[model samples]
Target: MDIQKSKQLPKILIITTGGTITMTPDSTGGVVPTLTGNDLVRSVPDIAKYCECEVISFVSKPGASLNWVDLLGLAKLLNEKLADDSIHGAIVVQGTDTIEETAFIFDLLIQSDKPLVVTGAMRSAMMLSADGPANLLAAVIIASSNMQSQGTLVALNNEFHAARYVQKSHTGHLHAFSSPACGPLGCVLEDKICQFVKIERKSPLAMPKNEIASVGIIKAALADDDRLLKNIPALGYQGIVIEAMGAGHLPAHYAPYISEFSNKFPVVLASRVPSGPIFTHSYNFAGSEMDSIRRGAIPSGLLGSVKSRLLLTILLSLNYSPEQIKTEFHERTEY
Candidate 1:
C-alpha cells in the first residue's frame, strides 16, 4: 500500500460519516458496520497512494440514522474546509440510504469550487472482491482532477453525478447510483479525466446564521392527511418539502394547509415519482400547482423531496422572499 508520498499530490480531506464502505463482519456472521476514520483509511490503503488524504472522523452512524443534526454539523464543518486553501478538495464517505439528502444539503450550503465529492461503498469491506476501495480511490481522483472547481459532485461505481440528481437504486450492488431523469455530468477512467458537463460559478452564498434547532422531511402519499401538516408549523419546523404526486399535486386534503403555510415559511413541492422534475399545475385541481404557486409554495422542478428540502432550508436561512426563492431555484438548475 506504500507509494511515494509527495507534497505535490493533491490534498483531499476525506470525511468519514460511516456507511457500508466502512462496515465489516461481526462474530455472528452478520455484517457489523463499525469503523472509525482511521479504520476506514486502513481498510482502503489505496487512498495513501492517491493524495495527501486527511481523514476527518465524525460519528460513524449508518446513513439511515443520520439526522438533521448530523447534516448541519457536517455542512458547517465542510464550510470550514472550504475556507482552507491548503485543502484542494473534500470527500464524504457515507451509506447510500440517506447520502443523497446529506450531499444535496451540503451542495446548497457550501459553495466550493474545489471538488467536494461524496462517495460510499455498496458492498462491505469484508465481502469477497468488495467495491469500497475502488469507489474511494475513484472519488479522490475526481476531487483532485482539473475539474475541482466545479460544484459539488458525488462519485460512486465509477460514475460522476451532480448533487441535484443522484439517487440510490438498489440495496446491494456495484451500479446502485443513478441520475434518473438526467445522465451523469461525467465519468471517471483509470488515470484519466472525462467531463461531459459544464457549471458556471455564481457568487458564493454564505451559510445562514439563523437559529434553526432542527429540520425534518415529509413525503406526500396517496391519501396524505393534513394531520402532519396541521402540526408542522406549530412544531416549529423551519421548513418542509412535500413529495407531491405527478407534477407536484398534493392530496386535495393538503391544499388548504399548503395555502396556509406558504405564507409562513418555506414550503417546497417535489414529485413522488422519480424520473422527471416536479412541475407546477400538471393537473387541473381547483387548488392545483398554479394555485399553490400563487400562494407562494416553491416548486422544486426536477429536484426530489430530499434535495428540495435541503435547498429550501438554505433559502429559508438566507431570509429569501418567496419570489426570490423561486427564481433562485430555477436559476441553479443545469437540467
Candidate 2:
C-alpha cells in the first residue's frame, strides 16, 4: 500500500447500485440490502481515508432483479459522472447476482479512459463475518489507482476481472466471482491493485440500424412455448437474441420462429449456460447451429444474450448495418 499521505488521491465517485455491501440487519433479524449512500460511506470508513470520494447513488434496490430500464438509467448516470473532469474514476457497489451483467452493459455503452470499477460483497455488513469492507476498500483502491484507468472491471474477493468475462459463481462463498474462459485482468493485493492482463482494447462498438431493435431472451425447456418469437417483431423490435441451449441449439419446434425472426430482424443466437462462446456447426440438426447461421441469424460470437443485447442496442442506436453490428459486436473494447 502507498503509505505517503502527501500523495494526492484520485477523485472517485462511489455510485451505489444497491447490494449486500449496503444492507444491514433489520429489527426482525431478517437481512435486507437497503442502506443509503450516506450509510454506505459510514460502513467503510477506510474508504474516506484512502482517497477523495464523492458518492452518487442511483438505486437502493437489490441488483438481482435488474431490468432494461434500470440498465438504461444507470448508463445515463455513468455518462454524466464521467463527464466531470475532476472525477478520476467511479465505483458501483451492486448486487452480486447481476453485477457482472450490469458491468458488461456499461462496458458496451460507455467509452472512456476514466476507470469504472464495479464491486460487491457476498455477506452483508450486519453479518457476523462480513466481506463488504474489504471488497469496498479494494474497489476504492482500484478506482483511485492508475492501473485500471480504462475499461470496466470487477473487484471482488481480491480478484480483478474484466467486466465482460466475470461471473458470480457461488451463492455464499467469499470468492463468488470468477472469469471462466479469461482470467482476471487484475488482482487486489492488500490495499493495492496489481494488473496482470490487458485484453480490452479498441473503440466502443456502434449500435445497429433498426426501426425498432430489442433484445429478447428465451430459455430452453422440454415443452417450450416460443410465443415470444411470434409476438416480438410486432412489438416494434427489429432485432432478436435467443438464449439457446447447449452449443446454441434450439428446440425442433422453435425452428420456424428462428426462421421467421431471421427473415425480419438481425437475429443473434447465444448460449444460456455459462462459459464458452456460441459457435455455429457445433451441432448437426436441420435447424441446428449450422442452420441458424445459414439463415439470416448471426451468432453472438463470445458474448451472452445480455451483452449481445447491449451491443445490439448501442449499434442499433447508432444506425449500424447488419454486417456492421456483427463485426462491431466483437470489436475490441478499450478504455
Candidate 3:
C-alpha cells in the first residue's frame, strides 16, 4: 500500500512491541508475534489518510514478559522521539496483558504534553475478527489529533481511557479495557474524536538513574502463611505491595510479620477486591488495615496492587525514605 505524501497531516510514530495484535499462528498451533511495525501499518491502509505514519519495530515479546527495565527503555526512547519538532505524538502497540501497568509507567515517566496512546488486541491478528487494525487506526487518530488532553492514554474499542484508571477487566471480550472508578476520558464517535473529561496533568517524575528497584506483590489468602512476608527483604526486594482481603485485612496470625516486614522496607497495602479504596478505620482486628497502617505500612487508597507496586518501585528507585514514601502515597492516593 502506498501512502500519499502530505504536508498538512500530522506525523505520528507507531512503536510496535509484540502482543496479540501482532501475532500469527505458528506450526505448533500456538500464536507468536511475527508482524513487524511496517506489517501492522500495511495491514491498516486507512490510517495513512489520518497521519503521516512512521513505524519502529521495538521488541517482539508478550507484554506479560516485559519488566521495569523494558518500560524505562521505552519511555526514554519515546522522550527522544517526541522531542523532535516534526513528530506530533506516539502510539505504542503492545500486548493487553500488561497494558495498564505499562501505560501507567509511561504516564509517570513521560514529560511530553503531546498525546501518547496505547492500543492492543485481545485476539491474534490472524483471527477471524481480529481487532488490531481498527484499534491501531483509532490510536493513530488520537495520537495525531489535537485532543487537548495530555499524558498517556489507552484507546481501545473506540473508547479512550486515561492510563491512570484503565484496567483489563475481561479475558477474551473485545471491550476488555475499562476505567472502573473514573469511567472513560472520551470516545471516538463517527470517526471524530470527542473528549468529555479534561484531566489535569501532573508534573512528571524524574526517571530513575539506577537500575529499577526490585518490587514484589503478594495477595493475602485464607489462612495465608507469613513466611513469604518474613523473607521478602532477605530476597532482595526493595519494596512490596500486599493485596489484602476486604478493606485490607490479612490473616490475624500474620500481623506481627507484617509489622516486622514494614520496618525493613516500604510496604504498601491495597485491597484485593477491585474498585475500592482501602479502609483505615473500619476494622480493629489483629491483622486489620488500621493495624497494618500503625505498623508503618502505607495504604493505597484507590490504587490496585499492580499500580501500587509500580508507585512504590518508582519511589524506591528515586531513593525516597520510608517516611517520604508514605507522604507521597498519601498525596497520590488521597484523591
Q: Which candidate should be chosen as best, given lDDT against the real structure?
A: 3
Which segments of candidate 2 are over 4 A away from where they belong? 1-7, 65-70, 205-213, 222-237, 281-284, 330-335
lDDT of candidate 1 over 1-335, digit per residue (tens): 12337888888888888888888888887765687767776766667667887778887878899876787788889888877988888889898888777777777778677788889888888888888888888887888777755667888878888777788877777888888866788887875668787655444566777754344577777755667877888888876777777777766777777778877767777778877876664566754777676667777777777677667677777787767877887876535
Residues 102-203, candidate 2, lDDT per residue (tens digit)?
888777766566888888888888787788888888888888878544578888888889887788889889988888777888788867767778874445
TM-score of every model? 0.87, 0.86, 0.95
lDDT of 1 at 129: 85
Q: Candidate 3 on 1-335: residue-level lDDT in tens?
A: 23556888898988989999999999998999999998999998788788888788899999899877688889999999988988889999999999999999988889888889999999998899899998988898899899634679999999999888889999999999988878999988877899888677666788899877888999899977777766776788888898998889988877887788887888899988878789988888798998989887899988899999998999899998888888888877776
Residue range with the least summed lDDT across 10 consecutive positions in model 2: 204-213
Q: How many backbone clashes does candidate 3 have?
A: 0
lDDT of 1: 0.76
Q: Which ten-residue region of model 3 has the weakest summed lDDT?
A: 1-10
lDDT of each: 0.76, 0.75, 0.87
Question: Residue 194 in candidate 1 has what lDDT?
Answer: 82
Residue 182 in model 1: lDDT: 67
Which ranges of candidate 1 are over 4 A from the true structure? 1-4, 201-203, 213-218, 223-234, 281-283, 333-335
State how far residue 178 of model 1 sits from its true place (Å): 0.8
Number of backbone collisions per candidate, in order? 3, 8, 0
lDDT of 3: 0.87
Give the CA lDDT, 0 to 100, for residue 307 in model 3.
92
**RMSD of model 1, in Å?**
2.8
